[model samples]
Target: MAKKPTKDPNYKVIAENRRARFDYAIEDDVECGIVLQGSEVKSLRQGGSNIAESYATVDDGELWLVNGYIAPYEQAKTWGHEERRRRKLLVNRKELAKLWNATQRQGMTLVPLVMYFNHKGLVKLKIGIAKGKKTQDKRATEAKRDWQRQKARLLRDRG
Candidate 1:
């Protein structure tokens, strides 16, 4: 029998960067801090928090994540944080400088991969450095993925 996928116990996904996979070839990943308001943090824990439309930019010696959405906390009072505000991403000086340099080149981008709570129960963001893929590259990737899936299915049947 084919083994089923296992879910991690500490798993709680706040957001996913779907376009990152479709558009870019991720080269390196980094875990960074997310500065969120109290209400935003509360809402994220309740689920449906996603950064699908988000992308990263470095400016003024800092990294920013724009277009991320954290829903309003239902129980929170007024004066809540903005749902689609640009949030700061924490990274060391060397990484920040490197990202800025990489972004200066054409077709390279910084994209969010996932947002989840760590073992310490703090929210974290997984960022990736990637280069954009062309239309033909996308098609090739899809074909390879389909072939792999079919191959796995045949192997399982034989076993």
Candidate 2:
């Protein structure tokens, strides 16, 4: 068998919105490029960014990331970027149309799932096409998770 490729050392997760999976059901996800200033990139490298409160939107034929937070870079005193400013997301025309249709016609949401550096050291965002979960749905999910944990524990003990 051919040797499996190893994980890329350059790939690193900067921020992840763990709550998104709990609050919404993710049907699909797409990787997107984000436009960032120098200061913002420096801040992300230092690793205090937050994507929990951020979301993606398709507007005027372009995708944008809104409410994303990148901590200010102290060294870049004069040219520091805004911490919560909207950032533009890059995607192809066909993907943009699909995202728009999902949001406008299917009533889905574009939730930011993770921000990470790819193998080539370029930053990327994974945005999910999700639908909001009802309270009962959340409860059922929690119950299922609890059962899974209990079952694992039982298996471990018996083995």
Cα lDDT tens digits for candidate 1, 1-159: 999967666667777877788889998888899898899888888885878888899988889999988888878868678888899999999888778888886557999999998767889999999998999999999999999999999999999
CA shift of 105, model 1, Å: 3.7
Off by over 4 Å in 1: 1-11
lDDT of 1: 0.87
Question: Which 10 residues in a row give candidate 1 its minimum summed lDDT?
Answer: 5-14
What residue pairs clash in candidate 1, if any at all? Answer: none
- Candidate 2 regions off by >4 Å? none
lDDT of each: 0.87, 0.96
Q: State residue 66's C-alpha deviation in candidate 1, in Å.
A: 0.3
Clashing pairs in 2: none
